[model samples]
Target: MDTFWKDLEAAAEARDADALTELMRAAAHDGGNGEPLGIRYDAARSARNNVDKYAEN
Candidate 1:
């Protein structure tokens, strides 16, 4: 397996969003796409809140 895959797996297992985001940014750059990823923190926060709300039930 490639180092990139290993790193990605580790980041995923650790639930490191920043690490995953950085890895995705690097992958995009390497693939010739310079556009920045539009990570919607608001949406993520909303989803997390919903999950937490439901989990509390």
Candidate 2:
């Protein structure tokens, strides 16, 4: 989880939308079939929102 956050932060810092999407997909896949889709969606949303918010600054 920490690694995911760190990588997300880096992607956000770089302002790489592709990397962000790929990371989210990778995270969801890693979460396994038992994991709920909502959780992955939320995680991706949070990361994307944060990146967009900070990009405006």
Candidate 3:
């Protein structure tokens, strides 16, 4: 949704890694495509890793 994007943008601008990860998790869970548990787990893990990697920049 528009709100999600706006919030994500705001989080990114603020360099809030935790908020970014949480938003990614929310999007993955609410996508409504019946994603498999494994896929969701992978996504969350990837999100965390990305947040960590970027936070170092």
lDDT of each: 0.51, 0.70, 0.62
Q: Of the pair 1 and 2, which is ahead by lDDT? A: 2
For 18-48, candidate 3 gives per-residue lDDT tens digits of: 8877876776667534555445445455556
Q: What TM-score does each of the candidates earn?
A: 0.50, 0.54, 0.54
By lDDT, the best candidate is: 2
Give me the displacement of residue 22 in model 2, in angstroms: 0.4
Q: Model 2: residues >4 Å from true position, as ranges?
A: 32-41, 49-57
lDDT of 3 at 13: 65
Q: Which ten residues in a row have the lowest lDDT in candidate 1?
A: 32-41
lDDT of 1 by residue, 1-57 (tens): 235556666665565666666666656445323334433333333344554555579
What lDDT score goes with residue 39 in model 1?
A: 31
- Give the Cα-based TM-score of candidate 3 against the true structure: 0.54
RMSD of each: 7.4, 3.8, 4.4
lDDT of 2 by residue, 1-34 (tens): 2476667678777877778888777776675345
